[model samples]
Target chain A: MSKTVEIRWHGRGGQGAKTAALLLADVAFKTGKYVQGFPEYGPERMGAPITAYNRISDQPLTVHSNIYEPDYVVVVDETLLESIDVTNGLKADGAIIINSQRPKEELLPLLNGYQGGVYVLDAREISIRALGKNFPNSPMLAATVAVSGVMGREDFLGEMRQSFQHKFAKKPEVIDGNMMALELAFNQVGC
Target chain B: MAIRERLSGNEAVAYAIKQINPDVMPAFPITPSTEIPQYVANYIANGEIDTEFIHVESEHSAMSATLGASAAGARALTATSSCGMALMWEELYVAASDRLPIVLALVNRALTGPININADHSDSMGARDSGWIQIYAESNQEVYDNFLQAFPIAEHKDVMLPVMICQDGFITSHGVENILLVEDDKVKEFVGEYEPEHYLLHPTEKMAVGPYAVSNYYMETKRAQRQAMLNAKQVILDMAAKFEQMTGRKYGFFEEYRMEDAEYAIVIIGSAAGTCKAAIEEIRATTGKKVGLLKIRVFRPFPEEEIAQALSHVKAVAIMDRSEMFAGSCGPLGAEVRAALFQAKSQAEVVNYFYGLGGRDITVQDFMQVYDNLENIANTHVVTGMYDYIGLRER
Candidate 1:
């Protein structure tokens, strides 16, 4: 019953957008908040566009419907902007974060005149610099937390570090890289 | 203390399966429900439980192997969706008729034709008369809790029938959410042991299952099956009460939300009920309308009298169905609920709606519109468009 933060993620099938949404739900739940993470399912293909959603609240969530008017929208794959209306029902006061190095001015036109704040994170650059890979989900997740202020910066970093440690327990070397990517993305997301 | 965790509906059921550690699980893979067997198989491989895992060729063999295990006095279960269930149709009835206490984890999906892999009630609705004690869930937590109770309800002395615990495919089945899980010891103790009174493997006595009843005894066997179903109503309540004592979560044949003094109401089942609840909360907060919802948890042993009593006070009701019966009148739930009201001699105005077919999203706004229609009907005492579809494209 409390105020819920609704988020929608747009990405390709193999992009880990769904994984990022679920990871957000995991961290939020660890903070003692009720959370839901689900992806809009379709025929599975490598390059097909897919959508995922998240709901975080202080109280239990009763609604099982897809988010129409989202408080925040994260376009995990910037190319999806041309094919999908990622901001179809986005709240004007809320924000849209895109993982593009093309600058916010170029992406704004594709959003159908969305008047809310637009945030751009050069996720590829950040990921390559921090982790030496093209994994944009880690940076995009951090950018979302940084832009939305869902949790404090320090708290989000701490949670991500712990999560990475657990996820990469066998391969402990990758934990630091993922954490570095998150911190760099958290600090570098620009309006 | 209940362990706080987060899991998808399939994982939750698999976790419960790990806790109960049934004797045998014969399964074949199907979307939405495939994760269940996959997880259970992982547990077996990891030595988490000693449950026998049977990988069969098809769903028919999966269910046939399950019934074989149950008749041989091993606690048995299986998981399937859509056409897999249709393939198991004959075994479903045999499990009930032969009095085998089998538990089936059913991920409710749309039956094929257009070849869709989405959530709907058609798969389970089509099996309404297959003699299984059907229980539905609106969330992951409910599905987990319902699975824990399925064995107790199905194996009770007076109600030795198969149980189908159904959740919407790709909705609760795939959605991850927060859940409180009972302790492993508590679940094991609650589910208890499945000791059938008669079994084929008995050392001193011999028993035969699936016997061909002659024309003289066929009707009596059916009558006995119906009696078991009738007895299940009370058994379901008793088991729910016991489960509440252990976990502090109350369950019943159905859940009534804000129905005390409501003039407009909606009757629904499965995950959509959660959406309806959200809409009801908004309606009460904004316009102060007395809107309410009746979410059915037990569908097979239809709680006709109790549902009638709950809806008797409402002026107008919208009964929503997620599957089409194509009977030209209403869907499966609509037909049963209308008949229940008519039998109870209630004068409430009722409308049946078909919605959410083939994974079409049903939002709170759609429910708000249904409530608005209910208000119109209650005030004017005239019913317009008694049978209709929600979220349908019309010319």
Candidate 2:
């Protein structure tokens, strides 16, 4: 409420929700905002549902507890909605964004009575077309930024490009594909 | 010229080690603390530092290798968590009694029974009397700053002892936060060159470190080490002051948050202190109750006098311990604080609460309950003479 944006991501261990949260923190930090990004470690294994959290703000943060009331919840894997309470402790004014091919209205019942905005995006198609793989991390991040307005779509694109350049220096195609997927996902989110 | 960065407690410590560029680092991996060695190994691989990264097989070997290097006069470090710390239990005393001045980046983990990889003070608290200069941190920034200060304190001519720069296992170690790092040049200069006066590998000086002493010499040697540790109290303060001037982040034996003119206060350590501060703020704002906190930063030397004086005027106090001492009287922090009070002759009603064992969550609400008990004690001058656990389920 004090200009801090808390977001939680629900996804499998290898699906990059944790990566998305950290990338957002790094990019948001580059944009001159205070940020915190960390994953709750359980018995981590591939395909096991894992949770990652973020707190981004203009001022420094002091509270270090797990985010029980998140401003935005991103379900990086739509299947997580069935097994996990994705909307647990969401703020009344918060929004839940799901990465799915389904319509926003169709996923409304899966919200567990959350009276907030529901947004969905066809992240798989966008990822496959842009990156030639099904890694939806960057797209989901872009979609999260788009729906939450935590970061401007244009600013995220620019920052993501700069970060990806360093992370994928040997493979320019990977950088280009991630950038393209982010932009397409930014456009694809429907509130 | 300090640089602003965002890093977790583990990364911050690793970055400090990167800047210090010690002579050797022999390490093994453990939960929550594994990231520290992993990061340092990466730095060495990238040639950011030329410090020897010895990939030891176990925590015991890690300590042995560290002592082996430090005795040879090469500045060394290693890291471990809960069980790993326990495995190195025997060597902890050797590192101290040998007066090797090794700086250990200990990420505090819970000593297992049911087995836990979470945050607790049991690991470090168990070694509080192991002659290591133990310092606890409440945040990532403190962890970084403390790691940078450790070498100076331990290597001081007066206090030739090992130092453990400890932060909570996953609570601070894994939690990312914004931090200001000192300029690399400034840190390197402050830690300075480690030119040992007498070491096993000295070219001209002949000396044997860590030789078994008979009863005739052991007590005197221990007396000298004890004096050195006592001298460390001032050395630690001096280093903290110097660190403050360089980085503008002042540190002390303890942090008394809003303790002035308070009738009810809670003393705690590490990450849970962050939550307690929030609860204190809420109690102050919503209930008009003046609640304060005394968060312990340096645990080994146990700033008894300063802590006693700080809580002298408070009406009722709650000392929260993340690890249970199981010592019939009280937990470590509680027993120490009670002793400090007895010495100071303060009449403040004090109670002990053992919480967050095995990394059970100690939330703002949990602290709120402690505050309520403090208030009740404040009114009636009575306390429930019972050991308490925060949020522990009774079967």
Candidate 3:
């Protein structure tokens, strides 16, 4: 494992790229890990492409700049693959997890010359099946953790439940569905 | 042992305020710093602390209310960033001239005109001559710790002046990280209670606060204010030493990182120090160059002698500035360090570089370039332009 794990999330503005990045850091902080989670800020609208970042480390993190050479990338909306250079400046040995129904081989063309682990999952279908909605951020986050091995699947699930409980306090059903979707994606992610 | 929590810089400052639980807090919202007041408001509403928060209409009124509460002998505080702080421009001088010891949690952002809401030192640096003490923090922990220590420095008997504790706007203000929090009771004991020798609310003493001084007294009043700021240099050192003993987190006017017997060094401020440290680490690993860093934690009361002494040993020093000073020399920091080195008559060839204006990203390679320039000067001692900008799209 690297001394620090830098993760970049590519997704549309309305999607939970910011949420996933921040939630991952929040949970990491709870486990006594040093973390930084921030979205690259611009005057972005609802559906525009946006990026968020995370720096998770066992020791104190001294780098306060944005992550350019991310160790892992999570593409919450696979549509972003066509436009943004999702693998730009990504480390050669880094891994990527894409939330897509398409096979890993199908997504390989988009990440040319990456030469890294590629994990694919039908995160949207998983979330829709469990939550009756199209939102796949929580499940994509779970997939990210499972594929990157930055943290244990159980640790991710436990933190996801706690985060959802606090965030969706008034909607108990929403919280349960998010938890279910997170676990499903975690179990199903594969290259 | 301290309690550990995940908090953004604003949340950490709010937590410090919660522990201080000062008598009054006058607040108005501005980007980056807006969350600070929001969190404090929530803290007040939740009964976590008993700070009387005055929701003012504008940033000017926020500072005015803070001055009023402080003049009335209450420990008062406020928060603002960028334009909000600019709005309080006139009052910033008043808070210091009146010798009111108030703590302003300033989230450093770019000032208006071309209008960007990102991290820069222009906001606080613009007020560098406003007779207020300024301290810059590099991390969320320093943000919390600096806020706690600022009170003693400003309120000391010899230095009854206002202080601004600044952290990068969205960089530190909105960015989340793990922070160690001092126990509430321990902080309370350390800060103690606010006791001003003279106050507007004093029952037996008839006195004036923020009064108009005639020509005869105006210069002397200004001089007294200047002297107070000068006296604060030592007071800050004393307070930081005491605070370090309490929390095991040492602080000073400036921090020297890996500077022993170094031939090249860079002096920087605020959040960018972390990035430079990373660059220095990488450079030292690959090239084995003897590079070091001198990050100025206290910008005001400039720490001229101390900083000059520290950088005097290096062969070539580059004072990095986040904001532009268009005056041909580097920005404010570069300008001052040049003057300080002149006073010390140090032979180090100094250059200035301005970067990250209006939130431009400065990468590790960019800093490595700065170090390379310094290394060249150290070897040949041929100085280039007085100043240069990093990562600019120049022809």
Candidate 4:
């Protein structure tokens, strides 16, 4: 458990929260770490709140259960903070990274007095400035990596660049936008 | 050298299918399992493998077409979950009785009554008596490995029965994890080719399949099927040995973790066994308790004697089931394991627990509590409750 890092994602359906979790796993795996990425699935519905999880460890992971006490919690959709307990069972020593433009003071109360270090990133701003669309998945993923220290910034960026090149091969321009979004988000989290 | 890759269980199984390049795959879409065929279809469309992909209207047709192809001396398979498997109920028996040796990639999910789509063993557990050789996986890697062995085990001359390779739906089927894949040429050589001795399309010999059997012949046919299942216990081990030699992973009828000197143990199947293993490690580390886990890999041949021998040293054992049998006493795994322990004349106090039914989550904490209960049971020698439920809410 000491070497393992668990993270949970809170997002609406189609927000790519699940995708972000998987990307984290993919990046972690590239660094030779064992990883698990999965979503708590339900009936398909648009804008419905969804949860996904990640377990990154140096040793091989055998546990298949949901993360009850995650070291970090990522809120992809800030509105989910009102409906879901985003900090439930979150470690106090760890932190919660939220994709919001709101000031920290406004969002802190919404966390039900969570004592964890709360880091805020304007993912919408970052994605819009970089990718010209509000695709928060990239920024949120980068923020989680920076906050959790699952991998160094250089390793994360290198792996993500290769993945984006492969994923967006047909549209070469989209790769730079995504990389920019990751960089903007990574630096904004102050890592 | 093994290829290091990350893939969901479905992807891993489909990758194996691509490597094996079976002759035919006739399948209909079902939740958690639809991705298996979808990936295969993508493979075929991309010219990666030339497997004949048949898009069927229903799971019934899926199984029927697969049976037809296999009987026609072609390697055939299909994938399904939950009600889709129920739809193929009739063909399940036909494939086994006719000895088609077809393989089925099953992602275990709950059957519909109230209508839910999540991970559970109700579907495969329902087909426990369908004459198919059932093998359950604890993770994506295990499912990939189990599927690689399915063809060799099913196609064995001594055990020519259909095999169902099962994994927890959405749990392993959808979750992405790190896995080591054997090289394609090695997989090709390992699975080899399916060459049936007798078939409907034989050039020289005339053959018939699924003919009407009277009561006298039917009984013997069933007995032969039983004998085939009994033979599978050995074939499974033999194939596992070969698989381990090719790769570095060792598999058996059941995996015994920390069981050598345990006073309390848990017998479980499927993905939750991984969670139980995590719990065992924590309990042993913190409390210095001798807790162990017996994760069953081969559920069909049951491995009765071996399981009893493995748990013989334990003072108490909790047999956990992810599916409810509605039999008033215990679930399917519990019943079979209790029977095995009984026949072996072991005095281990046993309690049956029904957990994770209908996609419910079983956490490590829940498992830790189960171990705590086992300790209490072993110490008191009084069974407060023999049949119980975990993660169940009280009214």
lDDT by residue for model 2 (A143-165), tens: 88888787776788888899889
- Per-residue lDDT of A178 in model 3: 82
Candidate 1, DockQ score (0 to 1) = 0.90
List model 4 lDDT by residue over B1-395, tens digit each: 78999999989999989999999999885553469999999999999999999988999999999999999999999999889999999999999999999999998999987798888899999999999999999999999999999999999999999999999989999999999998998998899988899999999999899999999799999999999999999999999999999997999999999999999999999999999998999998999999999999999988999999999999999999988788877999999999999999999999999999888999999999999999999898988765999999996
Residue A3 error for model 2, in Å? Answer: 2.7
For residue A29, what is the lDDT in candidate 1? 87
- Residue pairs clashing, model 3: none
True contacts kept of 3: 0.75
lDDT of 2 by residue, B124-241 (tens): 9999989999988888998999999999999998998999999988778987788899998999899999988878988888988788899999999889888988899999999999
The alpha-carbon lDDT assigned to residue B208 of candidate 1 equals 85
TM-score of each model, paired residue for residue: 0.98, 0.96, 0.96, 0.99
Provide the clashing-pair count of each candidate structure: 0, 0, 0, 0
* Candidate 4 residue spans exceeding 4 A from truth: B30-32
What is the interface root-mean-square deviation of candidate 4? Answer: 0.5
Range of the 10 consecutive residues with the lowest summed lDDT in candidate 1 chain B: B27-36
Taken in order, the candidates have interface RMSDs of 0.5, 1.5, 0.9, 0.5
Q: For all the predictions, what are the DockQ values?
A: 0.90, 0.61, 0.79, 0.91
| Residue B308 lDDT in candidate 2 | 92
